[model samples]
Target: MTAITRLTVLIPEVEPAHWWQCARQNRSGAVIDRALRRHTDAVVRRLRMRS
Candidate 1:
């Protein structure tokens, strides 16, 4: 006698129009990412003495 195993996978149906749009859709923690980006940009601007 032998045993059989089965596997299943799920996929999304919607299609993205752009590469960046697709990447963002699959990402989490957008608020944190935006905050960190803003902080880094502010620091860079300050160091560069930009208004």
Candidate 2:
């Protein structure tokens, strides 16, 4: 089971492991096109698994 580690009322795409995490973390359907580095992808995937 993915334990809710983050305390933010935020969704699953905000405040990523870096600056280009995603711009839509605040809004629901913003779709921030900032391309995250490859390393960022790994982190986000790990986080997703935990969430």
Candidate 3:
């Protein structure tokens, strides 16, 4: 038997119309964007360390 490890990133689904509206007038878009960037950076760092 083999052990398996998995990482999953859950990105919220935002409708294009709603996204555009929030991006234009709300800070929520910026917060979500920052979180995504941080998550991506951590994943990349882990991949590099493994290699």
Candidate 4:
């Protein structure tokens, strides 16, 4: 069996355009940074497990 972790970001109150603009401008925002870190960590963990 395989286990998968899914992370979802919800910003229902924010306008789509504005949210996208902010994300584009601040790629290193806390939320974005955390998500990226989690994703990278998952990939690295998988690779290590395979070796």
Candidate with the greatest lDDT versus the true structure:
3
The global Cα lDDT (0 to 1) of model 3 is: 0.44
Q: Give the Å error, residue 7, model 4.
A: 21
lDDT at 9, model 2: 25
What's the true lDDT of residue 17 in model 4? Answer: 51
Each model's lDDT comes to: 0.40, 0.34, 0.44, 0.40
Arrange candidates, best lDDT first: 3, 4, 1, 2
- Model 3: weakest 10-residue lDDT segment is 42-51
Better of 3 and 4 by TM-score: 3
How badly does each model clash, as a count of residue pairs? 0, 0, 0, 0
Output the TM-score of candidate 1.
0.30
Model 2 pairs whose backbones collide:
none
Q: What RMSD does model 3 have?
A: 11.3
TM-score of each candidate? 0.30, 0.18, 0.29, 0.24
lDDT of 3 by residue, 1-51 (tens): 999665554434343444445454434544665676777643221111110
Backbone clash total for model 1 is 0
lDDT of 1 by residue, 1-51 (tens): 899554322222344566566664543334445565666543211111111
Cα shift from native, residue 40, model 3 (Å): 1.5
Worst 10 residues of 2 by lDDT: 42-51
Q: Using TM-score as the measure, name the better of candidate 1 and candidate 4.
A: 1
